[model samples]
Target: MSHYHYSADQLSQKQAYKFLTGAIAPRPIAWISTHNLETRVTNLAPFSFFTILSSRIPLVMLSVNRRPDGTPKDTARNLLAAQETKNETARTAGVIHIVTPELLSAMNQTAASLSFTDSELELLPDELQLLQEKDAPLAVENAKIRFNVRPFQHQLLTDRSDLPMTDIFYLEVTDFYFDETVFDAKREYILTEKLAPVARLAGNDYSHLGLLETLRRPD
Candidate 1:
């Protein structure tokens, strides 16, 4: 077999991004759904750069970036709602909310650009439930798991010093909601199979979790 070596410097930023994003294969997407308490807007969007960071404390992180125009993203804007929590329950529970696989399509629709006043809440079919907690919209009727985030920090960095980007928000997850079907008790395990979760891939592609394999660690 013959192989050719290519230097990282040989690639353009866009090229490098495509190569990395596509080559990474399957990625789990946090199909986030948030409702703006003040604006009365519900935004649904997907982020492959999301994952649960810790379980003991039940922490989740969403590595959100600025909009293409270098403006703060809608999701980031919703985090500001955290600041309005006057009640102890809302303050302790956090701001942004999370939705799981069940409402993936509805969440995707929220990603669309509509009038700020348009209500995505009405778009949900009668079957889905939109629970209001401290004035936050939640896809509880369909979601298998949901999370509430407490704003921890926001960092703006100049990665290239010449770029019109580089903003990251670090949030602390405070409250969590999980359906009974997705978890097991006797074994103390999360039954992923029952959840039928979907994940994101590069370029308008996604996948569902399938199959499982157990491999013993070699000591």
Candidate 2:
């Protein structure tokens, strides 16, 4: 057997990032939508650095990296502002949508580099429908599954001088909306084949569901 190793500390930031992203296979993409309180414009973006943090509390975490200029990304900034809102009734909220094969093109369009004040939803194809949740931000109509989330906690991963590098958001799911086509009523589970979810790979690569297998847990 043979293995290769590289020390993260000794490697450049780009090198370490490439290694980590390449090593992490098939990361779930979080298609998040946030409404800018000050701008009153909606923002949408995809982040693969996301996962469920606590199933018991219905919490999910999103790791948002700062831009090259060390400025907070629009999504992170909006979420943090939402967290600090004092008015319960007017507090900001967001929506997390599932990315499927059908929505891949639209999702990629939203990833385009745009000003913080610009709304990405405007770039999406005209065929794509955008819907707004009761009090939450806008959501994709074609998404198979969508979660209405509210910011629960926000933490900045910073250096010694307190220069922020990444923002970690813990959001609590308040509501779930699933398309009937991908849901199994009797089994109470999502039909993976029907969902046809897309996942992120290293660089500009993405993956489909590919092979499916069922592994039973050992008693």
Candidate 3:
């Protein structure tokens, strides 16, 4: 077999990102929705660098890459603003949804950058354009799974020269909504196969579940 290996220092930031994402098999997508409650402006987007930080405390983490202009993404800013505000009703909160293969196209469209005053909700598909109700995490009644998160910690990563690259949000999951089809009330378990989550790959590719496997660990 042939091999291709290069030092991290040899690549530019863009090159490094490309190579890293290309090799990182399948990463789950966090279809994040940040809302300005007063104006009802939503910043909906998808991020792949997301993972569970803690299961006991119900925490999650997602890294938002900065723009070419060195500005933090809207999702990052909205969550930060939410943390600072005293008003609970008006505070902007992050509502994270699960992505299925069928929703990939609509998810991509939400990735388009809009002005601070503009909203990405305008571009969402008809089914997902419902209004977000107060004290609701699912956004809509039929949503499969959604996590209502509050950002408690943020880490700004920088390069060698101190140039900022991404903002890492350590979010505390406040609540979760699981539809009946994907959840077991008595067992308190999520049905993964029914959820049908989609994952992000390199470039413009995405993948769904295939070939279930089960390998029990040794006791």
Candidate 4:
């Protein structure tokens, strides 16, 4: 086996992006759900650009990209709306339900870039069941865990002065819903074996988190 290294200054932006994305291949998918205030449409999409931002503050982050014309994507726009809900009365309704193999097809459909007026739910309405209280659509039968995000801040990248920019959303998780079968009393946490979460790989590929084994760190 061989290893290659590039100094920070030596790496071009394009090279850096490719190296990082490829090196970090097979990242977990964050299947986010959001609602459009104008159309009242609920959208769900799988984002490899998602992760838990914090545990102390119960925060989550979703990275989003702007269109070539500088318009925000649906997920970004909906997140902005969710943030507004937070500032108004300090509570948010929409939640993000994670996608597993069971919901792969529906997840793909949601990822389709549709017209702003077009309803994504129209593609897989039967597959997705909305949990009414949250007013957010989820692949209830397929999802193993659902996390409700109460937004604290919607921050733009300071370096995003360039056109077709990138943005980061910092959200505080308010609720956690999970399938009983996925939890283990012995472990005091959900079993990855039962959950079978899907993760994104390079170029139209995905992998699963299989048979985990824990190791204690050397102190």
Best model per TM-score: 2
Candidates in order have lDDT scores of 0.63, 0.89, 0.79, 0.73
Model 4 misplaced stretches (Cα beyond 4 Å): 1-18, 85-90, 125-128, 134-141, 158-161, 185-187
lDDT of 1 by residue, 1-219 (tens): 998566888988678767777888676666555667777677666677776677776666677766667766666667655544534455332333344566667666655666657755666667776666664555445677666666566666554655546545565666666778887867867777887777766776667677878999999
Give the higher-lDDT candidate: 1 or 3. Answer: 3
lDDT, model 3, position 32: 86
Off by over 4 Å in 3: 37-40, 86-92, 129-131, 135-142
- lDDT tens per residue, model 3, 140-194: 3344888888876888898667888789998888878888989999999999999
Q: Residue 78 error for model 3, in Å?
A: 0.5
By summed lDDT, which 10 consecutive residues of candidate 1 come out lowest? 91-100
Clash pairs of candidate 2?
A: none
lDDT of 3: 0.79
Return model 1's CA RMSD, one decimal: 3.4
Scored against the true structure, residue 131 in model 1 reaches a CA lDDT of 68
TM-score list, all predictions: 0.78, 0.95, 0.90, 0.84
Model 4: per-residue Cα lDDT over 1-219, one tens digit each: 897767977887678777777779778777777778888776766778778778989988878867767778887888887666556553454467777778888878778988877766677757556555544444344567888776677776544365657778887787787888898767779877878888877766778777678899999
**Candidate 4 total steric clashes:** 0
Residue 195 of model 2 has an lDDT of 93
Local error of candidate 3 at 116, Å?
2.1
Ranking by TM-score: 2, 3, 4, 1
